[model samples]
Target: MSLIHALQSALGENAVLTQQADRARYEQDWRGLVNNPSLAVILPKTTAQVAEAVKLCAAHGARIVPQGGNTGLVAGAVPILGPDQVILSFSRLRAVRDVDLLSDTITVEAGLTLATVQQEAVKANRFFPVSLAAEGTAEIGGVISTNAGGLQVLSYGNMRAQVLGLEVVLADGTIWHGLSGLRKDNTGYDLKQLFIGSEGTLGLVTAATLRLYPPVATRASALVGIENIEQGLGIFTSIRHAAGNALTLCEFCTQPALSLGAAHTPNGRLPFIAPAYLLLEISALEGARDPREMLETVLMEALEKGRVLDAAIAQSERERLDFLALREAISEGELREGGAVKHDIAVSLSRLPALVRAVEDLVARTYPSLRPNIFGHVGDGNLHVNIRPPAGQTMADIANHKAAITRDVESLAISMQGSFSAEHGIGQLRLLGMAAHKSQTDLALMRAVKQALDPEGRLNPGKTIPES
Candidate 1:
């Protein structure tokens, strides 16, 4: 029997889709920037089914592209040219396997949405803090595979830090059940780390055991206007000193970003306008000091020290949600305006100002008519620097400059000791950036690891690691 026939026989007819419309849905990524459709789309409902499919594909020497939610910014989740691959989507395996409130861990299927996990934690009176703009649609499997970091990363680290254990399906159709709830284990190797951010090149993650937190009883938020990036940094330090570990999020936004958001969103007006703006939030358990009082004290100190030009504190839950909407909607608003050259980068906290200055000078010198929209998770030192060309420039002209701009910006990031890919993974887009910044020895070691795991190169080829 043929490979397609074998797969269809193993996983029922409803699970295997071969029609053009069915396969087209899994072809493109979230940005609509890439479209590489596959020969078939396999929707597995259980881990055993996934293993059976993998074994069949291995016997046939076929390539498999594992996917979830299909909300990735990078093109790693889609297929590439010259490969008649099969797309294995985990959307049907949407199940919450287990929840341990006392141990503060939850085991969920990879297909469950991040928002659904958060809601499940809330139902149990616990908290799961891995949040992002795409939480409503991004699945737990994609977040684990990408090791995504969002606004709350300043307090609660990235996805890798929150995961206690994972249950992965190997390339040969064997299950590696490393799903332990232990907080500390002196076991050898800690093999689960290998597949956490491997981008599905190592193995397919079927389920995961994630860490949870105690629910916060009181939450407080504030929107502050600052004069410049320097003042924004100063405000961060002041709030950290006053609130300590209670500070959950500190986000920075530029004047142009706020203006664009106000122009696009129906109710997304900035609370107070200045050269720069920041959104600060605090969360605390019951019987602890009032979070609102802590925010007020911190803001008053910042005001006295000239770190803040103006500020507005939210008094109700609705106001807090409205305040967050302004920060979340800016990117969409910018996209609606025109084409942009975007970068997700990070630097040391002390060197952020100098780094920004150097990049700004370089852009001004090279592209005289470009305006940059600078904003991001300032507390974590990750900034999204987007370049918008002057009005009247044709889209083709702007599109042709991306290669040059990416090269210069990535080189500067290397010089500043920052990373080229901060939250976004190194998909096909950053293969060149990785080659330019990564050393020959490091690249060789990565290739060796990939080969050791997937010898046939049958899993998500032409992504994460460059061709040898």
Candidate 2:
């Protein structure tokens, strides 16, 4: 039997997609930057089905691209090669296997969406805090595969923290069922960490054990206009001191970011005009005092200290979501400005200000016509520095300037001891960046691991670690 027939036999006809139209969705990425045409697309519902499909692909020596929700910014879920590659999509495995309330953990199949996991936690009166703007569509596998970090990371931590264990389907058809929920597991090597942010190069993730938290009874959110990013950092420090561990979010956006969001997101509105703004949130356990009063107090002091120029607290749940909508709508805003070179990078919290200043100076000096759309979880020093095209510029202009712009921008971030790829992970989009920046020693170690796991280089070929 042919590979497609073999896949169909292993996982019914409905599970295998072969037609171009049927495979189009898997071909393109969320950003439309990477397009990898697949010979076939397989959608397996169960872990066993996934394993069998992988074994078949390994036997055939055909390259496999493991995919989740396909919402990743870096084309991590999209294939790199055409025709010969098989897109292994995890869209059907949406099972919640176990929920241990006493242990504060849940085991779930990888294809389940992140929003569904959060809803499941809410149903059990617990909280799963690994969130993102793409949560509604982003699935557990992609979340674990990329080790995503989002709004509440300042307090709750990233996906890496929320994960207790995982079940991965290795590159060579072996299954590693290391799904232990124990908080203290001192087993040899801690193998799960290897696959957590491996970007599907080492293996395909099919399930995970995730941490949960007590539900928050009280919450608060505010959008504070600031003098600039420098003062935004100062206010962030002040708020962190005042809010302490209660500070769940401290995200910032420059005027360009706010303007972009406002232009694209219908719900987006600027409460005040300043050089920059910060969206903050605080949440507390049941019976705890409302966090609004605390944030308001901090905002008042921030205003008094010349850090915050203006501020408004969300008076209702709708208003709070609206405040978040403004921040979340940033990408939509950037879309209106035409093509952009996006950089999701992170520096030390203290060095973030210097990075931003240097980025501004460099962009103004180099890409004289373009403006930088800067916004992100500043509390964590991770920001999206997207160089959106200037008004009236053509696609050709963006194409002409992309290579040099990306090189210089990434160079600046590396100089600041910052990462070129943060939560987005290094997919095909950043393969060049990885080759350009990742050190030889690091690459060699990574290659050794890849060879050990996927010696044939059939899984996610030409991604994450650069080709040797």
Candidate 2 lDDT over 257-368, as tens digits, reads: 8777777777577888988888989998988767988888888877787667899999999988888888887885565556578888999988888888888998899888
lDDT of 1 by residue, 1-468 (tens): 988789889998888888988788798876666788687899989999999999998898778999988877667798888777889998988899999988999999999999999999999999999888778988899899989898799899989999989999988889999999889998798888898888898899999999999998989999999888888898899888888888989998889877777777676777677988889999888888898998899889878887689999998998888877787777777667775777888898887888778778978999878887888888889988878877766445688788888888877777889987889888667888888888889999989988888888988888899886
Candidate 2 backbone clash number = 0
Q: How many residue pairs clash per model?
A: 0, 0
The best candidate by TM-score is 2
Could you give me the TM-score of model 2 versus the true structure?
0.98
Cα lDDT of model 2 overall?
Answer: 0.87
Model 1 misplaced stretches (Cα beyond 4 Å): 392-395
